[model samples]
Target: MIIYQSGLITLDYDPATDILFINWPDVQDFLVPEIRQALLILVDHIKSYDIKNLLIDSSRASLDIPGTEYKEVIKEFGHNLMQTRLEKMARILTPNSTRENKVEEARQELRFPIPLRTFTDSKEAYSWLKGTLAEPA
Candidate 1:
């Protein structure tokens, strides 16, 4: 079921898998503040629904912010996410994009607080969230 829908994002919950799926709007079309607001809304649903697994499909998104500013915002989001009930998160990135490697690197680095991973395939992400895919060793 869709829990929230806005110009910046759309959130759907799958009770069967206990996962929340987020479809982020194209980052080139919106400012960071707008995206941040949508993310805050997502956190609210995550807390309210006790979401354990999250899948973010950002295959069409890309940030245009400076490196320093991007890092700052990511840090803030990380702090907020650590306070949630999330155990794992899978993000689907644009395949073959220039930023894919960078995003994957960030994913690996941020895997401490939660088991976060990046994928270029949505089916892979969904399978991982549904516990059908074997966890990496």
Candidate 2:
């Protein structure tokens, strides 16, 4: 069920799967600081509900953060996630090579403690989260 809805993002939680899906607003761009704050709020929801899996659909929203700011944001997000019960996260992004590369760079920098993957398809993302995909070697 949808727990939060705003012009920037919409949050939905599925109790059966214990997954929280964060859907970004279409045609909206957010600065690093704004994104960071939003992320903290999202983390709070995960903590409150004890959510273990997260699906972030970023196909619509664009991040307007610079390279340095992006690094900081990812660092803070990774730190906050570490304190939660989140075990896995799947991010669905638009098929933009530059944006995808930037996200991968940030992921590598964060060295996130839990499993995190990116996909261009939401179906594939959710399937992986549901453990329908083969485990990585």
Candidate 3:
């Protein structure tokens, strides 16, 4: 019973939580054209929604595959910040990485205009996005 709406792409909108779950199912490797289109779609969606915060659940996505420009995709979205009111963003990463400093790494790597955090749990992410805790500069 996911209430989904279509703009340039498909999105599951949770009005109760003000959460938008983007489903870019066609975002696989070897599809540069679609990837570019998806990025544009994402930008348009954010602009339309005037979204200020997001919890991007990319854990289910395999972006590390060959021919997939993960960084490029991220950069495109990250760079589109000025036009959108996006203030906070968080990603749910898999537990595979030995790297323990993912939060800091994500903040630095993403190059967003506002705060970005990576979490192992979605609840933590939700809390953090709701400003339950003061952000550290």
Q: Best candidate per TM-score, number?
A: 2
TM-score of each: 0.85, 0.86, 0.68
Better of 2 and 3 by TM-score: 2
Error of 3 at 107 (Å): 6.1
Task: Quickly count the clashes in candidate 1.
Answer: 0
Q: What are the runs in model 2 whose C-alpha is more than 4 Å off?
A: 26-31
Which scores greater on TM-score, model 1 or model 2?
A: 2
Clashing pairs in 3: none
Clashes of each: 0, 0, 0
Q: What local distance difference test score does each model get?
A: 0.78, 0.80, 0.59
Summarize candidate 2's per-residue lDDT along 5-41 as a digit string, tens digits: 7666678999988889988654335555667778889
Tens digit of per-residue lDDT, candidate 1, span 1-137: 99888877788999989989987656877787876777788888899999999998878777786655655566566667888989988988765354565554444556547878788898999998888988788
- Writing each residue's lDDT as its tens digit, candidate 3 over 1-137 gives 24334433466555555555564343445365666676676667667777677676655554433322454555566676546777777778744352224434433676556777877778888778777855668
Clashes of 2: 0
Compute the lDDT of residue 77 as modeled in candidate 2: 81
How well does model 3 score by local distance difference test?
A: 0.59
